[model samples]
Target: MQFENTREFARQLDKEDKLSRYRHEFIFPKVNGKEVIYFVGNSLGLQPRSAKKYVDEIMKDWAELAVEGHFYADKPWWDYHERFSEKLAKVVGANPSEVTVMNTLTVNLHLLMVSFYRPSGKRYKIICEEKAFPSDQYMINSQVRFHGYDPEDAIVEIKRREGENNFRTEDILQKIQEVGEECALLLIGGVNYYTGQVFDMETITKAGHDVGAFVGWDLAHAAGNIELKLSEWNVDFAAWCSYKYMNSGPGNASGCFINKKYHNKKDIPRFEGWWGHNKERRFLMEPEFHPEPTADAWQISNAPILALAPYLASLEMFDEVGMPALIQKRNKIVAYLEYVLQEIDKDVESTFEIITPAEQEDRGTQLSVFLHGEGRELFNYLMEQGVITDWREPNVIRLAPAPFYCSFEDMYEFGQILKKGILSKQKV
Candidate 1:
């Protein structure tokens, strides 16, 4: 499809878009009395209009029922997090029994590591991507330290080829093979936060397993933005935050996927609490912990009802629209965004080099552009003009055109604004 940098073309595309109407479901921020074209869904999603209703329901229940709300509220606060299992399983392509909602992303990762990241005398090293999200780096480093190992020896980072912006699948596979028996675990972000590259999880998971290593993914960016089949991939475990593409509020609850093979295992070690106990026998309060025979076995505490409320609200929308529809729009819109960037670059003296993978399958909704011959002034101009985007160090701006709310018109308008910002700088 030929993409044109014109309002009419953008409007025509939006008119044909089946997902266009869903944009109204969200509330956007204003800059100078107009709704901004939001491009930072990779950072934080816009608030779902239904989020307040979800939260208010919980608030009303707490007011009316007091402590009894745990058992009698409309959602039943004691089992609130259970509501996410079915819907979230669909989103991440896992069985309902294999999925659960619990603590925040990094926290869940830490908890999951208790079971998946076991290291022994001869096999203690972990393989991860080079320059992983800072939080992940910190988590891995701390986990290794807690296990009494130096990060320098225990962490094997798969570096990108010297001058490349992304990791090659062969390089990743080769590194996994090289790590061999020493590799206790192989975990990497499903969607790279920096270059927006989508790794080949199925193949990588198989490679990890073949090498006698546990494999998992940090799906912070991949959970709702790209296609995932955690169970089919035979991933041992995975975790993702709901506040990004999932459209839950800030620092909201996270979703986890644990393979059914790991369920009800007596040998598997985990950090457990009352919520993970058998529901029918939980009130008994026996001293021994009998974990629930599913992913909930990883739960360390009771569900945070208020936090899960907005997440449930967003999951309902995902169920209604389905991932196939979202991915369809995502592919077209991201391509159109790339086309707009190219067209705008042609008009301006500055060059916009999209560091993200060119193939649709190798990328998701985000395009990380290397703004050559430009600086922070352009980013500031964009922000002031209500173009909400994310700025990384060294003149890179991450633009994620979230399919549910972002529109083709936003892409075209952003191109215009970008051209103006660049030309304005040249005149100075």
Candidate 2:
């Protein structure tokens, strides 16, 4: 699709977009009574208009039903989480029984590591990418220490080659093979947070399995942003936060996937809670833990209904639109954004370089631009001009054109503002 750096061309594209109607379903933040050009959905998605309505329903149920809300409320708090499994299963490409809504991402990662990251004898090393999310890094380090192994000896970080900004799939596979005998677990981000690179999960999962290691993913950045097939890819486990691409409110409940192959395995140890007990005998208060034969066996506590309400609201939209439709619009809009950025790069000899992979299949909606020499001053300029973007430390600015609500016009305006910001800095 050819792109033109003109407002009229953007307007034409917006007019033709079938998903444009979704923009009205979200409430955008305002600056001086005008809506800002929001491009931060890759970090925190815009709240759906239906979120308040869904949350209020839960509040009303709690007010009226009180303790009995556990069984008698409209949605029944006792099993409120059961409502999301089917829908979320579809979102992550898993069977309903393979998915469960539970704790936050990092917490779930720890819980899964308990079962999947077991190291025995000489096979105690864990392989992960360099510069994983800090939370994941800390969790892996602490878990390694918990097993009485030094992190320096037990962890192998797959790094980019000199001067390269991304990892090659072949290099990652070779690394897995190189440490085959010592590797106990292979944990990686499905989509890297810093570079927005979507890893080849299927190939990586196969490589780990071929080497006799458990493989899992932290899908915090991939869940609602890119296409995933946890089951088909044979991913042993995965976890993701709901706030980013899923548009749940900040710090809301997260979703987890445990392959059905492990659902009935009694030998797999987990941090058990009463909620994971068999529903039929759960109220009996049995001293023995009879775990559910589903992903629910990993739940360590009761679901937080209020916190999950907004996520349900957003999932309804996903259910209505389907991921295929969303991905369709995503490709075109992201292409438009890339084209706009490239046009700016050419037109102004821009000081920034786009570090994100150029291929649509290798990335999602986000593009990380590394400023050659400038700092946050240009980012501040864009913020003052009503373009809300995400800034990383040092000199990177991330712009995401979310398919759910972001418009082509938004991308065009961002390019215009970015050009102005660059030219203005040059005049300085």
Candidate 3:
């Protein structure tokens, strides 16, 4: 991983990358028809070219087969959804039966909340990070209110110590123990959207289970960004969107996970739909619900086969390169990014701080930079220079070097652009 300089280092690294072949699989963003250095895969991944072909297959199925496509056509649209469960499960570290594709992120969170976040009168509280994504916060708030409880009282928000930007594991474990008596469920983002902080799910799950509480995770930022073992971690339930690191396209169908332990539990109240019924009896149209004994029981609607097409294509790429192999490259790329940020003139580097946890295990693909004094104009300047990243108002600009498409040369170019932008802003 040693480098003589940025550009030469890029060609050398690309030479050694096992996943290097994946670069051509995607279509990068264009600015005035030129390729822009896209680092916002943490927000929206670059689309794969095969996505169109995947869609075309479904289109042909619809057009040629017409009404017969549902059950009698090749691959049978009626069971097409089943084809991907095994592939997706490989990515998220779950069994095929323990996963299902369905509604979008926030909607799936709401559906999972219906079955997992059962709050009783005395022990009714959700412990979540204070700076969680707005959609997750809103979902938790509305769910609390739906249960006839005040969000202010029912949602326990965790944060770093005063004047701190991130929460430490010790603090999180201590807080869970302190409030374990009242907490009904633990619902946290697998990775913080703004800070790029990756929570230790195994420890968090164990802490909640120790307190006799259910645990769930919002994997909007974690899935495809980091290696996850949801099944081995024994997480009770989880939901994630695929548009970001998953590269499924904007607002693509989301995937959800429910621990197999909950599948046979008769007491866990689920908001059931026909799609979640046992496949053996799905077409029976029986009045009584016969729920599947796996995460598929969480499904409330049919899979969006058209919307999920990109998932299949993108996942196929992961399968070819392997998830761990891609992550290995990201670890080096992200560390290089952090190094470049720190190498800027001391005065300039001090002007903004990277809020992402420094440890390799504590973050995924994103680096959330908090502007120390200059405010957001620096982010705008970078954008104007075609270094397309996402700015979360107030002060944070999230930079993500997606392994599938981002290059070391892109990161190097970004550093020069960033330094130039900061220098220009400082002169003002």
Candidate 4:
């Protein structure tokens, strides 16, 4: 538990790590002929070494079977996405019947809104966290506009207490209550992208429902990085991209969860397509849309087989390792990363203020640190030295020591590199 900033100490921890060997499963980028210590898994995950094989299988199938690949390929392109339901349900803590893979994150959210974001008369306002991911902001704004309401009046943002970096749970619940009868939808990022705060989704979902609002989560960061029980939480709906911690390729397919309560409801409005029709009767091509009695009912088009291939590859790994193992390593590694940052700050003139919540339960793999008396030069120096991290505006660098590939040694080495960068800047 006592984290020391030394290579030996880091190596000792790594030796004790059960997940250490899994690092070899991924292919890392090289800087100056050495694999970089990757910390940007929150932005984009490193390519799974098996991803090529998955894609190649699909390519080979397309070549061999042509249009018949839909029925003849090893994965059978028509039912390709069905492979994800069981594995992905385990990852997000939902039933296989409650989850499905479909379009990208924002696109799924838009489609899900057709079923969940119904606003009429007095119950028209939507409650979301302040400064949500830009894409979410744009989606909410556009959705409100499309429904013929001013965003200023229809969108209720729960602001953090003046100087706080994260929104308090009480503040969020109170805001939901305050929105009250006017709250038609409550959608928030399960883990905040900026501060790396994990919202109390279960409690918030209850609060939203108590106020007669439809609740959902944008799990872009939370899906694989944190433990989620979307079904137990009774979340009405949720969506997440596979490209981040899920380790699918960039802009890959997304996963969704719709509560079983919403399934097979003809009255529930949705933008339907042929894929959502009853599979047994789909070939009949009847004019009326008889929805599939599960989350797949929201599917507006056929599965993107090529896109889902890499995702299936990654999900197999997740199934093999399990989330409990991932979360165990995530907690220890993130704490070690924080300790390394603190140790380096003690030695350097620059200050590293971690804005992420100190509690393990309140945070995930990411540590958003404000580098006082430092600038983008530090970030550039890090990148050049084979340290891949993400930089936000105003001297904040987001370091996500993903448990999948990030080692404890990486934490120690990054501390050394960071200290050197700061000391070198002072000499100038």
Q: CA lDDT of 238 in candidate 1? A: 95
Tens digits of per-residue lDDT for model 2 on 1-428? 67898999999999999999999999999976889999888889999999999999989988888999899988898889998888899899999999999989999999999999999999999999999999999999999999999999999999899999889999999999999989999999999899899999999999999999999999999988899899899999999999999999988888999999998788998999999998889899999999998999998788888998899999999999989888888889888888888888886755568889988899987888897877789899999989999999889988887899999899998889889888888887
lDDT of 4 by residue, 1-428 (tens): 77788999999999999999989999999999999999999999999999999999999999999999999988898888889999999999999999999999999999999999999999999999989999999999999999999999999999999888999999998898888999999999999999999999999999999999999999999989999999999999999999999999999998999999999888999999999999889889899999999899899899988899889998999999999999999999999999989988888888899999999999999999999999999999999999999999999999999899999999999999999999999999
Instruction: List model 3 lDDT by residue over 1-428, tens digit each.
Output: 55534677767777877777778889876776768888899888999999999888889989998878788766677677777788788888998888888889999889888887888768898999887888888889999999999998999988889888788888888889988778899999999888888999899899999998899999988888889899999999898998999899998988898888888777888888988888899989899988888777777777777887888888888777767988899898898888777766463744668888889999889998877776677777877777898888778888999999888878778888888887777676
- Candidate 4 RMSD computed on C-alpha atoms after optimal superposition onto the true structure: 0.7
Question: Which 10 consecutive residues of model 4 have the lowest summed lDDT?
Answer: 343-352
Worst 10 residues of 1 by lDDT: 343-352
The residue-by-residue lDDT of candidate 1 on 174-242, one tens digit each, is 999998999999999999999999999999999999999999999999999999998889999999999
Ranking by lDDT: 1, 4, 2, 3
lDDT value, residue 418 of candidate 1: 89
Candidate 4 residues lying further than 4 Å off, grouped into runs, are none
Residue 67 of model 4, lDDT score: 95
Report the error of model 2 at residue 229, Å.
Answer: 0.7
Assess the local accuracy of residue 285 in candidate 1 as a C-alpha lDDT between 0 and 100: 84
Q: What value does the lDDT take at residue 129 in candidate 4?
A: 90
